[model samples]
Target: MSNEKITIAKRIAKELKDGDVVNLGIGLPTLVANYLPDDVDIVIHSENGILGVDAAPDKSLVDKDLVNAGGSHVSTKHGACFFDSSISFGIIRGGHVDVAVLGALQVDKNGNLASHKVPGKMIPGMGGAMDLATGAKRIIIATLHTNNGSPKILNELTLPVTAINVVKTIVTEKAVIEVTPEGLLLKEIAADTTVEEVQSLTEAPLIVSPDLKSFDVAA
Candidate 1:
């Protein structure tokens, strides 16, 4: 993985509060598990029917039947429990998850998300993204700042929206942003990066926070 991905994961891990129940979406969002502080008591949920998820297990300990929502092998926490998808999604759609860290293809100024499919591309359907996006009490988008130099954050989504106006926070390699009723706010910038640099890669208008601070990735 690139340093950019690791940085995004580390920053997002800091957002998890004690006792929060979080659902980590597939792809980059899954990396957040590795960076979470051991002292923080948070339960990780996977839609495939595991709760209290821990980090990925070593290759030798991997179990084919025990995996996360993304189908990657993972170790279970001490109190972890297994159930069917019915119960898993019930926990999600019932508004029990405190936070959902999701990966996005595009996020608009309105905090809309587009991650399911690309136009004319083959996909395995939308999966549980729609439910998680709408059901979670808080949504945080964890993705790259850009896709091969093209801004993923835009004034408006160019693709089909996965969820409408549900995102609360966004963490990229270069910055941490908050979505509000007004617009996107720049909360923190990575060290050695500038507001101008972030803005240059973002299509939406960004309002810099008065109390903006440098993100300490090494922390």
Candidate 2:
């Protein structure tokens, strides 16, 4: 991954609280595990039926047979356990997950998610995205500011949605935007960027935080 992408993952990691049961969606969201704080002790749950997941293993130590929901190679923590998909979905549906970190294609001002499908492309099934988005106590969207110069955050969604009004926080490479009842709030800008730059790149109108600050985080 690039430095910006890694930085995005790092910023998302800060949102995780101790003892929170977090379900990380596929793609960039999967990288958050690599930068978790030493003091935080969130349990990583993979929808593919494993709990107590550890950080991404070194390439040499990765076990091909041990993977996350996205089919990415992963390592298990000391007490990691595995089970069938039915039980995995059961845990998710039972409201056992605290926070879910998901990647996005488009998120609207109203906090609706559209990560599953776009206009013209093939994809695997939704892969528990709906369940996680609805079941988790909180939902955080982790993504870059834009896709190939086009904004992914918008005033309204253009693609098919994954879930509606479920996102609580959005951590992108350029800014930390919170999806609130009033509107999408710009909480923090990146260290190297300005609020103007962030707004210029975003399609949705932003409600600037009263205590707005620049991101001081390190990847």
lDDT of the candidates, in the order given: 0.92, 0.89
Task: For residues 7-109, write the lDDT of model 2, one tens digit per residue.
Answer: 8999998888988899988778888977889999889999989989876689999887898886778788888899899999998888899999998889999
Best by lDDT: 1
lDDT of 1 by residue, 45-143 (tens): 999998899888999999988988777888999999999989999999899999999999999999999989898884657899999998999999999
State in Å the error of residue 203, model 2.
Answer: 1.2
Error of 2 at 161 (Å): 0.7
Model 1 misplacement above 4 A = none
lDDT (Cα, 0-100) at 142 in candidate 1: 95
Cα lDDT of candidate 1 equals 0.92
Superposition TM-score, candidate 2 onto the true structure: 0.92
- Stretches of candidate 2 off by over 4 Å are 56-65
